[model samples]
Target: MTVVLALEKVTKSFGPVEVLHGVDLALHTGEVHALIGENGAGKSTIMKILGGYLAPTTGRVLLDGAPVTYHSGPEGEAQGVVVIHQEFNLAADLTVAGNIFLGREITRGLGLDHAAMRAATAELLARLDTSIRPEALIRDLSVPDRQMVEIAKALSRKARVLIMDEPSAALTHREVEALYAQVDRLRAEGVALMFCSHRLDEVSRLADRITVLRDGSVVQRSLRGEMTEDGMAAAMVGRELTDIFPPKDTTTGETLLEVRGLNVQNLVKDVSLTLHKGEVLGIAGLVGSGRTELAEGIVGLRPATGEIRIGGRQVQIRSPRDARAAGLAYLTEDRKEAGLLLDKNLPVNLTLSALDMWGFRIDPKREKAEMTRARKEFDIRAASDEMRTGALSGGNQQKLLLAKTMLTGPEIVIIDEPTRGIDIGTKQQIYHFVRALARQGKAVIVISSELPEVIGLSDRVLVMRMGRIAGEVEGAAITEENIVRLAMGLDREEEPA
Candidate 1:
């Protein structure tokens, strides 16, 4: 393999606090490199520097043996380097062809020529073996369709180096397969791919090399198969991870949660379910499925006509506070928007739900004690108690969010995409934590898009499709094909069983 890009002791920092210590990374042509680390570990910082989103504090970046520094994505684009972020950059209102050649539109030696751009975009999609219509508006497209356009956009720039972060989070098995084929095509074309994901299974299949980041520094960097996941996980966390999820043997009581005639807008229609004590009920669905809305409605985050019962007692919940008071908790799908107060500190975020639990006013000792316990248990690393949570890595921030709701000790918890943007190590911790919650006799509901995660954690599974429960398939029927079939509105068994 030929060296495509290399970082020589690159160091990046923001203000007085250093986010990334001196670190080195290298990638060769025609290979997929996996970057693994905890949430606050400096993975994004390194990628940002390479992609020209941020300048390195020290050291150098070399592209094919030539030292270079970039000031923006366009500058990097001029050098054939592109970073496709987790959030799709295409404009929703624009047509696929328009987004592909947004800035560099073809012209008839004068003004913009729509004909040429559409023709070119159509060819590009066809080349990728996709039947996506270039004239179709992105707003009407699916997540997978949007991703395919993004991939086509990258190729339009002739991107030599591509960075994919959590590409599989919103994809189904079939979509993932199509994406993998595209990735292989890119790799075969001598494009160097640096991928980041929380899914170790993906890393095991795709990456030709792996680099482990821990505490703002490089812990291990080696060719493919040189290190095992167990070894990589230990290095990334700087400790032995005996069990990601704690063993659970706690037997649940009788049916602890019951829902009836739940009806909301297009997100959730008439639906109902029952959850037993100490049961982890998994809700699997594709993007835009009714799973999230159902969780929200049950917790009173959204307006709905439904009856929610805890331990056979009917309760009235109209707001988040009402939900908490009713012994229920919810972790939102979008962490930035719903789960966290990005500007706050770890203690403040962790104690968000249980402020009253600390007594009148704010007892310094009790508040500190509560925050300290969550920090230690969740393994949230920060410079000090005074440090802001926003400065932490994505993984640590997510952990603090988990600590936020669970601190209240709610009887039933609703968690949406618990490990979406986190790292593999953090994901492992969450799997154990969720299982442990059920073990402690908590009725836990996990809304997820990942099949493996749902199957691994749930005691029962509810599959949703198009604002309704498509089918309730537990134990013997929770296969990947069935879950997705229900999620995509293909399964015929309806009626919200």
Candidate 2:
């Protein structure tokens, strides 16, 4: 393998805070280098330097063994290095073709070559095994399709060095397999790939070499064969990860939330379940299986018809406010979009959910005090409470969202994808927090795509298939095989005849 891009003793600083410290990495042609780290561990900083979005405060970046500097992302792309950001970079108002060729349109004679751009976009999408129309507006596309658009855009640059951050975070299992196939094709073409993901299994399968970062410094770098998932996790967190999940609770109290015949329009249908105080009920299903839809319906985020009983008394929850008044709260899966006001300060976002608690005339002193307490309690890492919510890393942002949800003081809490895109260490922390909530007698519902996460954290697991409960597993019966069988509609318990 030939070295294509190399960072020698790189150190990056934002103002006075140094995030990347004396780091060194090399990307070889035809090799996938997996970058593993907890949020705030300096992975993003290093990626920014590599993508030319930021210049390293010290150290040198060498391309083809010669030192070089790129003044901007476009300059880096023009030189055969392209970055696919974790967040979607497409303009929502533009068509797929427009986004793919934005600022680099292929002009034939004079005006913008619309037909050429659309045809080229079609070819890229076809290569990625997607059927999205190039003429479709980005705002109308699903999350998965938007991700495909991002990939197609990157492919359009004819990149020699590709940097992908959490590329599979929003993809379904089938979609991920497709992405893996694309990665293999890219590698075969001798592209140097820097793949960053919190999914260790992905790193294990796709990487030729692995680099681990801890506390803004390189901790370990080794061949893929030299490290197991457990070893990599331990290295990234600097501790032996024993019992990643807390002990399951067996002493559940009386049922706190009960839903019968719940229907969320076309999304969820006739789903029934019960959650008890001191219990973490897990919901597991494939994409579009109505797991999130059911939770949204129960918490009034979506219009639904159902019999919702709180403490055995029937209640009507028509809106989020109504649900809150009924002692119920929901943490949406897309925390960056729906859950947190990213542009706002920490104090503002933290208190937004519980504004009624302080009345109409908001008290800045009380808000600041509450923000301080939540930050301490949730272990939200930030430079200061006044920092923008978007400035925090994914894990810390998730912690802040969780803190905001808990501030509503709901007796029943429903969290969707609690640790999606978060690192292993932060995931352990969230698992403990969920169990602690149950121990405090709050009924908890965890909806996740990761079967292991659902099984490890929940007292009982409910599998959904096509908008309804397929089966329930508990105790020793909640294995991956059983959950998959239930989710795929291959197995179901017989009803009393």
Candidate 3:
């Protein structure tokens, strides 16, 4: 195998602070090289350097055993290098075909060739086994569909070197299978692929070579057979992660929140549930299974006809303000878009929800004081408090969201996708935080797509399928097998004819 892309003695610095410290990496053709690290561990910086989105402060980018310089990402793409960013880079108003062929349009005669582009886009989407239409606008698609589009766009570039960041983070189990097939095909075709994922299982299954980075430096490098999953985890965080979940609270107290006959448009139908003090309840479901919709309805983010009782008193919560007044807080699943003000500073975002408590005059000193406390409490690592909230790593952003939600001082909290797209180390922190909330006698409801997370965190699991609650599992019964059976309707299928 030959090295197609190489970074030699690379060091990257942002203003006064240095992020990457004398890093070395190599990508070979016909191989999947996995770059595993904790969030903000310089993995993205490395990817950007290789794909020509950013230049190294000091070092060389070698192509075919010789040094080369690409002034821009497009220039690198011209040399068969493509990058699929973690944050999507598509025009929301454009059609799927339009986005795929945005910079390089297929022209015929005088104007744009709409038919030809649509046909080509359809073929590319078909390769990924996705049903997204080429004519559909980007804004009309789901997160998983958007992810598939990014992959299809990269494929359309005829990339020789593809760098993917968290490609499977938003996808469902079926979509992941489809993606795996494409990865295998690409590997067979001699494409050098470098992917970064928090899922160590994915890296173990797909990677031919593994490099673990901790705090901007490569800590360990190994071949497929040389490393175990536990070993990789330990190397990434520099500690033993044998116990990821906190111990489940055995004693649940009196019912604190109750919902009866809840209907959220047509997405959720007659869903009824209860949350008791000192209990962490998990909701597990497939995509479009109405798990999020049910949460939204309960929190008044969505219109619903239901009976919601808090502390044995029926309350009318037609909006988020009403919900907050009724002692409830909801953490949205889409953290980047809905949960945080990315362009604003940390202090502004952290206190956005609880601004009413600081009186109408708006005190900046109080906000800064609270942000300092939040940083220490939530373990939100960052270079400076003045930087944009968007610059924080995924784990830090999630922690900030948790802190913001907690500041509302609600007794009942609903967190959706609590640890999505974060490192294993951070996942442990989040799990413990959820348990800590439970131990404080606060009723918590956690909704997640990962079965293992649901099983580990929830004292009781509610499995939702197509706008309805399929079943519930508790204690020893809350296994992945039981939850999946409910989510997939396998239990119903197994019933007597």
Q: Find the candidate with the highest lDDT and give its number.
A: 3
| C-alpha lDDT values of all predictions | 0.82, 0.91, 0.93
Candidate 3 per-residue C-alpha lDDT over 380-478 given as tens digits, one digit per residue, 9 for 90 to 100: 998899999999999999999999999989999999999889999999999999999999999999999888899999999999999999999999999
* C-alpha lDDT (0 to 100) for residue 295 of candidate 1: 88
Residue pairs in steric clash, candidate 1?
39-393, 39-395, 40-393, 245-432
Candidate 2 — which residues are off by over 4 angstroms? 106-116, 492-497
Could you tell which candidate, 1 or 3, scores higher by lDDT? 3
lDDT by residue for model 1 (306-415), tens: 78898899999888888888889999877765677778877777776787755536667877998788878888777777777666767777778888888887999999
What shift in Å separates residue 114 of candidate 2 from its native position after superposition?
4.1
TM-score of 2: 0.96
Judged by whole-model lDDT over C-alpha atoms, candidate 3 comes out at: 0.93
Query: Judged by TM-score, which candidate is best?
Result: 3
TM-score (all chains, Cα) for each model: 0.82, 0.96, 0.98
- Candidate 2 structure quality by residue, lDDT tens digits, 119-198: 99999988888779999999988777888899889988889999999999888887888889989999999999998999
User: After superposition, which runs of candidate 3 have C-alpha atoms over 4 Å from their true positions?
Assistant: 493-497
Q: Give the per-residue Cα lDDT of candidate 1 at 310.
A: 86
TM-score of 1: 0.82
| Lowest lDDT 10-residue stretch of candidate 2 | 353-362
Give Cα distance to truth, residue 119, candidate 1, Å. Answer: 6.5
